[model samples]
Target: MKRHFNTTGPVIPEQHYCVDPMTRLDWEDVQYLIGAGKFFVLHAPRQTGKTSTLLTMMDVLNQSDEYQCLYINVEPAQAARDDVSAGMLTIVNNLVEGAAIRLKETRLRDWRETIWRNSGPHGAFSALLSRWAQESDKPIVLMIDEVDALVGDTLISLLRQLREGYIGRPGIPFPHSVILCGVRDVRDYRIHTKHHEIITGGSAFNVKAASLRMVGFNRAEIETLYAQHTAETGQAFEPMVFDALWEDTHGQPWLINAIGHELTWKDKTARDRSTPITLERYRAARERLIYSRSTHLAQLADKLREPRVHRIMAALLTGDENLSGIPVDDLEYVNDLGLVEIRPQIRISNRIYQEIIPRELTWVEQSSITHQQAWYLTPQRHIDMPKLLSAFQQFFRENAEAWIERFDYKEAGPQLLLQAFLQRIINGGGRINREYGLGRKRTDLFIEWPVDEEKGFYGDVQRVVLELKILRKSLETTLLEGVEQTAGYADQCGADEAYLIIFDRRLNVDWDDKIWQRQEQWQTRSIGAWGM
Candidate 1:
């Protein structure tokens, strides 16, 4: 059977299309740390190949006969919540099961029963691990996946057990190296329990030598993945397709794989392999993935409702830089959840995520809009932007206060509501590509509508650029700046027409003053400007 891109679970090298998992990590450093018996961390956003990487490393280590390696997922313990005894019991059971399956070790079964019988709840975890380690002539390497998934006393108990085991290593027959894997660094965990006890993972797991974050695949890695499919089938991707995929996904492992899967298996025409995959096909695959609400994207979209997630995302959409009151750990938490990237300036993790956030934020409002895509289409099936913007201006005038209140991201209320309206119009036959971020003070939109109404992303397509900005200064100043910015963005997208929507956020602003549209020229380019 032909190997395919995997997004559901851990990738098996021979069974699924995969890249070298160690390529995303400092493999040599990790090996050295483990060899030296230093407990450490392996963390990344979910579905970024963390589990696959650990399993691969386990195989490599066990094959070398230098150490016995086991990967156990402790996420089941999360169901026990604050019940330390129940949580530890579940975790211990999982480890014994994992060892039996992975290591073919029957001793773990006997050890589990013996440890629990002799030691009781708190002592069971360390005792079983110590027994398992001593059972092997080669020192054992313990990999606990989703170590931070549990919270409250459950999380504290797990961490403390690992730390105790780490401290007693070499002499007391504990695992030589213990690697905890999860989405966030253990230090970032501020676990709350039913008893109202707030504990930090750092204080509990203080023996951690280092925390290594696994990130999305880089540009070259993404290319290599795509290249594999092309090589196997004698089909080639258009040169620009690679750049487009990279631009949209930024090499997010799941997103990258999802695009490949959708294009190959889901897209009928693209599966033939004789027809080369073009940029149009790539963009179409992206849209299908976005609207399908695949498990990965849905998981990310779900994070928007979290308070910590809301705090950063709320500021992000509206360019609210006054985020001093937001906790640093909150920001880190959002980053860990893979909603946004922390380095190279804070922004949504990818283009699809940027689009999904607003769509999700104003989904109710979008659903409430009675207008349909056909209502905004011209005779040529082109988007009637002037009419759409005019309608939005009226909607803003009437429903701004009521609709904005519904949003956690109220500062970007106008932008979100407008997108909600536009999304309704674009949902049928076109796609909206969005670009917005912290400190951008602007949201850029590119609407791609098939002009001839052909059934694919190709054929004569109409592209329009819309720039949304908030009026922080005088209207005259903001208008001029917006005109230039809109023109620049239009030029970037190669869009024929551009519009600037400036939202007046001032108190006591009159309806007449806030609602208007005019045509202006910026550096020989004409830009339609709207005040809202």
Candidate 2:
């Protein structure tokens, strides 16, 4: 079978176009750590090739005569929740089965039952590892995947067991080196016992020597992966598509592969290979991927409900810089989930995520909206900005209270509602690109509508810039600042039209006082200013 981009699971070299998993890690460092019998962590966000890397490492290590290696996923034990016995049994069974399948090692299978019966839930895992190390002719290297998936006391028991085995190391009957892998660093694990005490993973597994993080593919790696498809089938991606892909996915492995799969397979016309995938087609595929609500994207959206996620996301949406109140651990936790970037100023991780966040938040509201796209279109089929804004102002006045109350992200309700309303009107006809981040103090929205239907975005595109802000200062001061900001953004985007929307969230303000509009001139550009 011809190789294709893979998104479903660990990449199989013969069946998929893939970058070498080892290239994404510090191979030399990993080897030294294992050789020195260091217990360490290997963590990354979901679907970024953590399992694939671990599996590849296991194969590489086993191929060498140095050590016997096994990789096991303990995620199934999550079902046991606080049940330490059940969780341990499930995890040990996975280890035994994995050893048999991957290494043709049946020693674990033979000894697991007796060990569990004699040692009980807490001690069985530790005892089993000790026996495996003692029995093996060579040193044993174990890789545990989804280590954080186990919950409560079960997770605590597992960590303590690993720590117990670590104490023996080379001197006693224990694995030479063990790797615990998960979406977050082991230090972030806050396992709760049945007694309601939160035992952190750091405390439970203090024997850990180091923590290593796996990052997304870099530019050259992404290019190489895509180039594989071109080499195999002679299908070409336009140069500009690569630039857009990088911006859209930020080199996230699954997203890069997902888009590649979408372009080559999902869109039938592109399968011909002779038809080069252009930037426009790539954009369309991105749209489909987002709107399809694929399992991967849905899983990310599910994290929005978490309190830590909610707090950071709410701040990002509203452009609030008051993140001082949020704990550093909470920020780190959110960052570890791959929701946002932390170093070069905190923001959504990528353009695709930036787009997904608003759409997911306003999906229900957008669906419930009864307004027709044609109702706001001009005679030439262009979006009537003035009329749309007027209608939204009235809609906001009527439904703001009830609708805003229903949002989990109530801090960003007004802006989210506005996006929802705009999304309803522009559903199929245009695209809205959003830009917001911590300390931005405003959200910049750019709408791209194709006036010429036959040529689509290739001809006569309507570009409009909408700057959204909350009333943080006097009306006069806000209008002046907003007009300047709107003008600057319009210049950057080369938008033909510009609008500044000020949302007065003060509860003391009356509807009549808050609802208004006016025209402002900024450096020869006429900008529409609205109050709500």
Candidate 3:
């Protein structure tokens, strides 16, 4: 059977086309660390193939006849919550079953119950591992996947238990090496107990040798993965699709696979080997994926609700550098979760995340808007640019205060409100593309609408550029700078209609003083201007 892109679970080598997980890491160095009895961490944002990598390592070690290695997802224990005894019992039993199947070891069957009853809840895990290490012919290697999924007291207990075993490794004969895998670094786990005590994960697991962060596939790796499909089915991806996918996803493993799945398997017509995947199909599939709100994307959207995530995102949305009240530790915490890029600029991880942020932030407002799609269309079925802006201006004047109060990102409330309003109107027949970042102090939006409603997105496309800015300078100066910027973006997008929106965030500005309805000729093209 021919294999395809995998987004649902770990990639089985014989059943899927996958990059060798070891290639993504320093294999020899990692092996050396484990051989040297180093307990360490392996973590990355969800679905970036961290589990697959650990499974690969287990296969390599067990096959080499050097270690009795096993990979078990202890995330199931997360349900135990604050019940430490239940959680630990579930985790140790999971390890025993995993070893019985993976290592063909029946030794656990010999002493499993005795160890559980005698060692007590707190000591059961340590006792079980010690016995296994002693009974096994080879050194034992243990991996706990989704380590962060365990919450509160359960997480604290697990960490301390692991630390206890680590401290007695050589003499007590516990697992030679262990790996704790999850989305956050060990240093950032703010584990809280029911006793109202907060314990840092680092102090609980201080014996850790090193923490390794897994990254997304690079452009070359993406190319190789895609080429596997071509080799298998004789179906090729157009050259442009690779570059487009890279730009849109920035090598995020789950997005890459999800997009690949949508283009190849989800669309029946695109599956035939004779029919190649085109850039248009890729774009259309991508839009579908976003709308599908697949599990991965939904989880990404949910992170916006977290306080640490909200603090960083609120600042990024408005082009602010002052993270004044946010804790310093929050930065690494967000980065470990892969919400933003750290070096180039503190911004959303990629274009998809960037687009999803505002849309997710304003879902409530978008749903509440009374604007109808058909109402904004001219008799000819094209969007009436001036009419739309006029509607927004009225909406802003009457409802901005109430709507802005609902948002955590009050500084970027105006930009988000506008996008929410635009998103509601362009629901089906068009797509709105956004560009904003740190220090930019402006939001750029491009609306791509199908002019030939019958031919749909295939025929002539209507492109309009909307540039947004906050009024910090003279009205004349802001408009002058905005018109120039709008004209430049319009030229880039080949847009015929352009608009500049300036938001005056100053205190006590009269509505009559701020409202404006007019158009200015910038160079050869006309630009509509709105003030709020």
For each candidate in the order shown, give its overall lDDT on alpha carbons.
0.86, 0.92, 0.87
| lDDT by residue (tens digit), candidate 3, 142-204 | 999999999888888778888998888677888899999999989998888898888889998
* RMSD of each candidate relative to the true structure: 1.8, 1.1, 1.8
What lDDT score is found at residue 18 in candidate 1? 83
By TM-score, the better pick of 2 and 3 is 2
Predicted candidate 1 versus true structure: per-residue lDDT over 185-229, tens digit per residue: 888888896878787888888998998988888888888888888
Residue pairs with clashing backbones, model 2: none
lDDT, candidate 1, residue 507? Answer: 75
| Model 3 quality (TM-score) | 0.96
Winning model by lDDT: 2
Model 2 quality (TM-score): 0.98
* TM-score (all chains, Cα) for each model: 0.95, 0.98, 0.96
In model 2, the runs with Cα more than 4 Å from the true position are none
lDDT of 1: 0.86
Candidate 1 stretches with Cα past 4 Å from truth are: 325-327, 455-457
Candidate 1 vs. true structure, TM-score: 0.95
| Candidate 3 RMSD to the correct structure | 1.8
